[model samples]
Target: MNSESLVKPCSYDPSFKVDIRSHEPLWCCAMTSSDVLVEMSALLSQLESICRKENEPSSQVSQQTGGKRKRHYSNTFQNHGMVLIERMTNLLQKTMSPVPTLLEYLESNSCAILFPRAVLYVKNPTAKHTPIKRAPMDGYFSQATALNQLISLCHQLQHDVTTMTNHKYIAHQIALLYQSINQLGNPKVLLDHRTSIETTFKKIKAELEKEGEKAPCLNSELIFWLQNLTSSLVQSVKTLSAELTSQMRPAMKYILQSTT
Candidate 1:
């Protein structure tokens, strides 16, 4: 099944209680309690065996001796890990108690989901920022959602500055992105250096545009100055993006490895 399909709709109550029966109900296939326990036990045992094999000292002995594992073995291990991850995630969805719904669990681990999307946006600059279009802007649902939007806008701002000739238009979009980021707030506790950059950006835009009004066209000198300004702004956004990712990565790693 598609991964997107696996994410069931979560209904919320005003009192902040989860209707667990409705959340991911499809996963609760009719089965006797004993049968479910047996199946879960077997799957857990198999997963443990695979993990043990992967973690064995002998496995690292090859690497320590400057010898790589055989290609087939490496592929097999990776496939096993993927299968186990899917199974475990499914099991968690199926078995979660109302005390902590899957949505709650996922929200607590929002950084896990956010960091990967952030990395994809940063590492692949040319890739389409698909999540940004549908991301929640309210900033209350999840930090991950807002970060997705911010990252996409940051990329768009960079692209616009580099490819668009209209400095005013690019600056306007940059201002919008900055405002969105500020409204989103820093849930990940990233060191905020954006205030100074944002101030500089506004000052530069105001000064440059005022000066440009005196000239009939954006001359070579003005163009050079605009290019430098755009470059600096892009760099500032990129720096913040990287710092936020770095702050969340450790938590993300823990969440990814979670079996419960």
Candidate 2:
């Protein structure tokens, strides 16, 4: 029998189906913020680790030396490869599937990691079906919200730069920063810094593009890219903080200006 025929087909248990109808929308108009970006980041790392472990060869010696395996041993590796492919495919699908609530998304087992603490903004789906009472914004104004988001974006960027394993994830992080800056009206000071940031990001992006979607190796150039990227992000955050301080306290701005 051919190697393909000798391998047994893998089976998987069906994922649990979430019943949206049974779950009422919890405060459709309410918006709750949490520091879940970093948590989600950690979850992504865990997923990558699992994928690597699953796809790894069963025997290092067999892989390195090209030694002949007994028929039964060969079969075991074949079975494992087949099962790993199926599991990884299912995981990809699950992670891509959209859910309304953070809780439901986690329960879906898309990530297949235990997320004990996730900071998330639970978006309500019921608002699409009907109008609901809007949440109060007494302490949460537009500028304040945008500033907070930018700060969070900087943190995410820094995290991605420091722990960059997959190029695709890093690309997503860069895109988030670009989108947020644009949404914030592309303030002049931020726009100036963005040029420097984008320059560093593009160099890293080019290197990653050449390497394709695999774990990156740390080289001197790559380290330099990461350091420059981190520095740019820190500068961006500082710029925003200063602007926010000026807006919140005009006297501070005047005092700093007079001192300068």
Candidate 3:
């Protein structure tokens, strides 16, 4: 999904009065939980294919040519692996679910692990590539791990919003969070959140437009609304994460066993 499509343009009109309560809900095409599962399965299959290809030995040939082919495949693997990582991240956040253990397993201790470094090198090919050494894995990535990370991030943002006096920064943060909700392709999940986001942001934009040159500051009402919105987001994501974990458990277990 194009990130640009997530947020619609907010047109400001001088005559238009901002009424937060009277705003209609934003509607979009609905997607089911089963559909999300199908998408996840497809991604897992593609990732698995890439992993298998990365591990395949180069065919016998002249030493120089063999090295070239190996490098070519390594580069290909890195590029594809990076794309999958991004897609997976977007999918997880969109579904309000955590990364599956099986997905992480397929990525660990493989060419997938090198994707981050590869990305850095791509940005600056002249920079020396330094290998990062880590201790042996104590545990695999799991749903709980991802959930904790999400909670931590939310808490950080919440703290920033509460303490920050800069209205523009706070507004930008709110817009970013609201835009993230639009990433939820599922109509069932998006409806309420989208409605809340749309009304709140429109009101804010209208207020800012009205203020013109004056410094923008959120009123108590807006602050309260933001708090409620964030609370709802956390609760919804938690519920969805649990549902996804339960639904995908069997499939994940099967994949892990087969890989072993």
Candidate 4:
């Protein structure tokens, strides 16, 4: 049987009812033996014809793939080729009878190693720059309420995340980071979280404010805890910064570009 993913006569068939599963790419060894030869021969044969006519031995005819020799392609020719490949890929994706989203494909088939891919095109997107979908709750006294919730959580946190993978510290730090990210959904929540963080620092200072001898081990432990929290906060801010640059900036650019 022809291997090269077999061009599955199943789903693609105009007669047969397409199995939705078949829309997902089946893993197969790259076009092997005769298949590669057949495709290459077809492509090269077409390429040779174009080269022969354009070169003409006696004189060089002007070629779309800019070069005196007619066979050699320049950077501009390669750029156009890339653009053509991208356009064709997009067109094929759209034209397919049944297509799976990238996320859908990712959900299945963990055994196979998949190449990382990213697509960034704005067809229709919300213009809102802020995270509106999951903003902190609103009420008569939301400001202090949210602030208190975060600070209380901070007070309760003693690197405690026993629920994840039977680990204590690693998962605990990640959970704290997650909470910080969730809090960032609202500008006020982010501000509140930061303010609560300062309260945490102040508490440490208040404890250390006692005069005379400070226990070395106790002071060291507090220092380590503070370092971890500070590092997590910095890392979170860095992530938000990059998100602003990559996602928000491009979105705004697209808005302006389309408008102009």
lDDT of each: 0.47, 0.46, 0.52, 0.37
Best by TM-score: 3
Per-model TM against the reference: 0.33, 0.35, 0.40, 0.22
lDDT of 1 by residue, 1-260 (tens): 64557668778758886544332336556654344334443443354344434433443335544785422135676565555444545655444354343233335544224333332322333343333322111122344545666666666755655566665565566567667667555523322435544555655466447753643234455445445544554454455454445444544444345433
What is the TM-score of candidate 3? 0.40
Model 2: weakest 10-residue lDDT segment is 117-126
lDDT (Cα) of model 4: 0.37
Q: For each candidate, C-alpha RMSD in Å?
A: 22.2, 22.2, 25.4, 20.5
- Tell me how many clashing residue pairs each candidate has: 0, 1, 0, 0
Candidate achieving higher lDDT, 2 or 4: 2
- Against the true structure, candidate 1 reaches a TM-score of 0.33
Better of 2 and 3 by TM-score: 3
Ranking by lDDT: 3, 1, 2, 4
Q: Model 3, range 1-260, lDDT digits (tens) per residue?
A: 64657768889877788654222225534545444445544564455445544444446545766454341246666666666555555554444345444344334423233233433332433444444332111122344444455445456567765787656666566666655554444445436866877777877766555546465667778877777777766776677553434434544554455345
Candidate 3 backbone collisions, by pair: none
What is the TM-score (0 to 1) of candidate 4?
0.22
Among all windows of 10 consecutive residues in model 1, the one with the lowest summed lDDT is 132-141
**What does candidate 2's lDDT look like per residue over 122-210, in tens digits?**
12211111211222221124556666676687777667666766545666666676666666665666776567656676665676676
Error of 3 at 257 (Å): 10
